[model samples]
Target chain A: MDKFNVGKHISGKFNEELEAVRNKVLAMGGLVEKQLADALSAIENSDVELAERVLSSDYKINQLELEIDEQCTRIIAKRQPTASDLRLVLAIIKTISDLERIGDEAERLAHVAKASFNKDQEHLLVSLENLGQQVLMMLREVLDAFARMDEEAALQVHQMDTNADRQYEALTRQLMTYMMEDSRSIPKIMDVMWSARSLERIGDRCQNISEYIIYFVRGKDVRHISREAMEDTVRGAKS
Target chain B: MDKFNVGKHISGKFNEELEAVRNKVLAMGGLVEKQLADALSAIENSDVELAERVLSSDYKINQLELEIDEQCTRIIAKRQPTASDLRLVLAIIKTISDLERIGDEAERLAHVAKASFNKDQEHLLVSLENLGQQVLMMLREVLDAFARMDEEAALQVHQMDTNADRQYEALTRQLMTYMMEDSRSIPKIMDVMWSARSLERIGDRCQNISEYIIYFVRGKDVRHISREAMEDTVRGAKS
Candidate 1:
C-alpha cells in the first residue's frame, strides 16, 4: 500500500486529513505555477501591471506555506506516524520549503518584468523569456508529477534540468556579449541576467521537487546521485 | 526543558542517540564553515589549490547531510517521539538541508576563485572577498547559536543578515561600475557578481538556521514575520 493512498485508512477522518493536506499542497503548487507563468508572460509582453499583480499575490503563497507547515507539524506530533506515513510528512515539509523558494524566484522575475526595459534591451529580455518558459513548463510537469505521485514522470522532469542549464548558459553568454558591445547598457542587462539566473534556479528547484516525489514513491533518497544510478534505481524499484 | 537538551530523556540510550544525531549536524556545519573559509581565503590569496580543495570537500558535506537525514528519520520512526523530541528531529531535518545549500554556495565561490583573474580585476575580487567574509562569519555564529540552542544568540545573528545584505548591495554596485568602465572585463565581472549572489544567499541561509533555533527554543513559527515582530516574540517569550 502506498503512503499517499487516499481514503484507505482504518480511520476515515485520518484519511480525510491526509487527503486535505495533499490538496492544500496542490493548491499551493498551482498558485506558484501561476505566478511563474504570469511573470514569464509579463516579461514577454512587457506588462508591468501584470507583473505587479504577480508580486502582490506572492504573500498568499507564503501564507499557505506557513499554514501547511504548521499543519504538518501538528500531524506528526499528534499521529506519531510510522514508516511510510512518516516519510510522507517529511516529504511534505521539504516540498513546501522548495515550493516557497520557487515563489521567491517568481517574485524576483516579476521585479525584472516590473523594471522598465526599452527597445534596445528587448533581445536580452526575449532570450530570458525563452529560458523562463522552459523552466515554467518544467515546473508545470513537476507539479503534475507531484499531483499524480508518478515517479516515471518525475524522472522525466528531473532530466529536463540539463536543457534548462544549457539555455541559461546561452543566455548568460548573450547577455555578456550585449554588455561588451555597449557598456552603457550594463545596468539594464544585469537585471536581465539576474532574471536568467532565477529561471535556472527555478529549474533546479523543480528538479528538487521531482526528486521528492521519487523519494515519496520509491522510499529512496536519490539526491546527489549520478543520473545513471538514479535511473537504474527508479527503473528497478517496484511500483 | 528545551528540545535540544542533550541528556534529559528518560531512556539514556535515546538521549545518547539524540545527542549523536546532533553532533553529526554540528560536524556537518563545521565542514561547511571550513568550505566557506577556504573559498574566501582562496579568493583573497589567489590560491587555486585551496579553491580546488573546497570543491572536492563539498561531497563530504553532501554525504553528511544524507547520513544525518536518515538518522533523523530513523529516530522519528523508532522513537515515535512527541513534543520537544519530535521538534528536534524535524528541526535537524530542516537544518541539514540549509547547511547543504550553504555548502553549495561555497562551491560556487570556489569556482569563481578557480577562474583566473588578472590584477586589474583585483578590486572587484576584494569587494567579493570582503562580502564573502561577512557571510562566513554569519555562518559561524549561526552554527554556534544552533549548538547552544540559544534563542538570544540566534536572534542576534538573525539581525546581522541586514548587514550582509547591505554589503552585497554595495558590492553589486561596485561590480556594475567595473563592468561599465571597461566592457572587456564584463565576463569576469559577471563571475564575481555570481559569487556575490551566492554569498548573499549564504547569508540568508544563515538567517534561516537562526530562525530554526528560535523555533526550537520558543515553539514559535517565526518565519515570514516582520523583524520588529520577531524581535518582540523572541524577547517576549518565557525561555
Candidate 2:
C-alpha cells in the first residue's frame, strides 16, 4: 500500500477529491521545476527572450497556487477531514506555498538574466548553473517524496540542501573577490550575486517542502529542529 | 459587538480558546514589531550588542509561532470549526508564518548591523531607518486590524506598503550611485543594501498579514488579486 493511501476512506468521493488535490499540487510542482530550470538556462545562455517567458509564465504558477488553495479550503469545509486527512490537506497547503515561493525565486533569477551584462563571467555562471541544477534536483525529489509520502526521500532532499548552502556561500565569496579585483565588474557581479541568492533561497524552499512532506508522513514537526536530531527522529520512526 | 465576535458561539469555552489564541498571535506580533525596530536601531547606532540581542531573541518569536500553530491545530481538531471559524484559524496560521518570516528578515538586518563599517553613510542610514519605521508602523496597524478584524485598516496597511516600496527603490538607486562613485565603498554599501532589502521584505510580509486579515474578515479569497480589484471588491462588499 502507498504511504499516502494509509488513511484511505470508505467514501470513494472523498478519496477521489484528496487525490485530485494531490495531483494538482504535483502539477504545480512540475511547472515550478520547469520554471527554475528554464530560468537557470536563460542565465547561462543569456537568453533574454527565454527569461521574459519565465517571468510571464510565473502568473501561471500563481494561478495554480490559488487553485490548489481553493481546493484545500473546499476539502476542509466540505469533507471536514480529520487526523491524517487533515494533515495531508495542511501539508498540501504548505507545499504549494513553498512551490509558489520557489517560482518567485525563479522569476527573480529570470530578472537577473534579463539585465544586460558586458563581460561573460563564465566561472561564476558555471557555479550558479551547478547550484541551480542541485536545487532543481532537490525539488524534483521532494515532490516525488510528497507523491509517495516518503519521509526518507524527503530527508535526503533536506540533506542535499545543506550542501547547496555551502556552495552558495563559497560562490558569494568568489563573487566578492571578483568585484574587488575590478570595480567595473561590480554591476554584473551584483546581478550574479542576486541570482545566486535566488538559487540559494530556492534550496531553502525545497527544504521547507521536504519538512512538510515529513510532517505529513510521520506526523512530526521537524521545523527548527537540528538536522542531527531530525535525522534521529526519522530513523527512530522508521524503526 | 466586536468585529471579531461576529460569529460568537454559544459554546463559551470555544470562544475563550479562540480569544486566547488571538492574544497569543498579537503578543507574537508585538515581539516581532520590537525585533524589527531594535534591528533598525542597531543599524543606525551601529550597536553590535543590540544586534546580537535581536538575533538571539528570534528563538522566542519562532517558539511563539509554534505555540500558536499548536493552538490552532488543537482548536481545529477539538471544535471542528467551519466557515468563518475555520477561516479565522487558517488566517492565524498564515499570519504567523508571515510574522515569523518578518522575524527572519529582522535577524538578517541585525547581521548587517553586526558587520563593522568605518564611514557613517548617514544619508543612507537615515533612509533605511525611515523605511524600517514605515514597516514597523505598518506592522503595528496590521496587528490592530487583525485584532479587530478590520478590512479597512488592512487596506490602509497595504497602501502604506506601496509607499515603502517606492522608498526602498529610491534608496537602492541612491546606494547604487554611491557604489559607482567610490569603488572601495562597495562592501559597506552592500551591507546597507542588504539591510534595505530586509526592510523591504518586512514590508511585504506585513502586506501578507494584512491580506490575511482581509481574507478572514471578508471571507473572500483576496490573495493574488490586484490592489485595485481587491479594493473594489472590499468596497463593493461593504456597500
Candidate 3:
C-alpha cells in the first residue's frame, strides 16, 4: 500500500477505538433502559423483589459510568482526536451523565413503588405505564441515533420529548384531581405522580442526549432553539 | 524578555481570556443570586410589584446564559486549550447551564408568590421564608467558590445543599401535616410548597455546579462519591 493508504489504515484504527467507546456507552444505556422498564413493571405488578433489584443495580450503572468516563479520558489523552472525534467524545461524556441520572430516577420510582406496594394501591398505575412506555421509546430512538450517527433521527427524538412532557403534565393534573376529589387517594396518587415525573425527567434527558448528537455532528448548539427552528436547521443542512 | 518570559506572556494572555469568562459567569451568578433574594422578599412581604419585575427580568438572565455559552464555544473553537484551560471552559459551560436553570426556578417561585398575593393567605408563608433563607445561603456559597475558585469552599457548598434539602423535606412534611389536619390550608399550602420546591431545586443545581468545579480543578469525577469521600479526595490532592 502507498504511504497515504497506510496513514488511512492508522486512522481507521483510531475510529475503531472510538467505536469501542460508543459500544460501551450503548451497553450501559441498554442496562439503564432495562432498569427503567423493570422499575415501571415492578410498580405496575407490585413486585417488591424487582423493585429492590432495580434500586441495588444502580451502583452497577454508576460504576459503568465511571469506567466509561475513565476510558474516554485515556482515549483522548492518547489519540488527541480532532473535529468529529472530539465531538463524539464530548457527546459520550454528556450522554453518560444523562443516563446515570435516568438510572437514579428509575431507582427513585422503584422506591416509591415499594412504599406503595404495602398499601396495595393500583389506581394510577396504567397512566404510569403509558408514560414509561413513552420514555422507553425515546430512549430507543436516542440509542438508534447514536448507533447510526443520524442527526435527523436525533432531532425527531427531541420533538417526541416535548409530547412526552405534555403527557406527563396531563397525568399529574389527572392524579391531582383524583386526590382532590377524594382525600383517601392522596398517598397512592402522589406515588403515581412522582412516577410520572420520573418518566418525564427520563424523556427530557433523552432529548438532552439527542441535542448532544446534533452538537457532535454539526458543531452547533441546538439546545436553546425551538423545535421548528431546529428542524429547519437540520433540514437545511441535510439538503 | 527571555524565552521563558515569552512562555509566560502567552500564558498571561490565556489567563486574561479565562478571567474574562470567569468574570462574566460571576456577573451572571450575581444577577440570579439577587433574583433569588428578591423572589424570597417578594413572597415574604407580598410585594406584587417586585414579583412582576422578577418575572420580567428572567428574559435577561436567559440572554446572559446564551451569550456566555457562545463565548465559551468561540474560545474552545479558537484556542483549543488543553488541560486546565479545557477544564475551565467545561466548567463554565456546566455552570452556565446551572445558572440558567436557577433563573427559571426563581421565576417559578415568583409566580407562586404573585398568586399568593391575590389569595389573601399569609399563614403558610413563614416556612417558605425559612426554606428560602437556607437556599439563599447555598447560592452564596456557590458564587463564593466561583469567585475564589476555591475547591474546599465549593465542597462546603455541596455539603450545605444537603442541609437545604433536609429543610425542604421538613417543610413539605409540615405542609402535608397541615393539609391533613385542615383541608382549609390546602390551596395556600400547595402554592407555598411549590415555592419551597423551587428553592430546593436551586440548592440541588448549585450542588451540581460545585461538583463540576471540583472535577474541573482536580480532573476527577466526584459525582457518585459520598460527600465525605469527595472531601477526602480534595484534601488528598491538595496535600
Best by TM-score: 1
Instruction: Grade the docking of candidate 3.
Output: acceptable
lDDT of 3 by residue, B50-164 (tens): 9999999988788888788777666665566666667777778778888988998899888877874334357688679877998889899889887777788888989888788
Weakest lDDT window of 10 consecutive positions for candidate 1 chain B: B1-10
lDDT of 1 by residue, B1-239 (tens): 35466567778889888989999999999999999999999988889999999999999999999999999988888877877787778878999999999999999999998998988888778888668878888899999988888888899889999999999999899889988888899888888999999999999999999888888877888999999889988897564
Better of 2 and 3 by lDDT: 2
Task: Give the lDDT of residue B151 in candidate 3.
Answer: 81
Cα miss at B91, model 3 (Å)? 2.3
Of 1 and 2, the candidate ranking higher by lDDT? 1
State the local distance difference test value for candidate 1: 0.89
Top model number, DockQ: 1
Clashing pairs in 3: none
lDDT of 2 by residue, A1-239 (tens): 36657446878899889988889998999999999989989988989999999999999999998898888988888888878888899889888988999999999999988887655665666668778888889889988888788888999999998899998888888887788777767777878888888888888888988898888777778888898988986888556
Q: Encode model 3's per-residue lDDT on A1-239: one tens digit a residue.
A: 12112244367777677767888998998999889888988988888899999988999899998888777766665666655666777678778988998999999898976875334356678668777888899998898887776889998998898789888888877876666666666656666766787798889899989988888777777876788888876788667
Candidate RMSDs in Å, in order, are 1.6, 1.8, 4.1
lDDT tens string, model 2, B147-213? 7888898989988988999999988888777777777777778788888888888888888888888
Model 1 misplaced stretches (Cα beyond 4 Å): A1-3, B1-3
Poorest stretch of ten by lDDT in candidate 1 chain A: A1-10
Rank order (by TM-score, best first): 1, 2, 3
lDDT of 1 at B217: 79
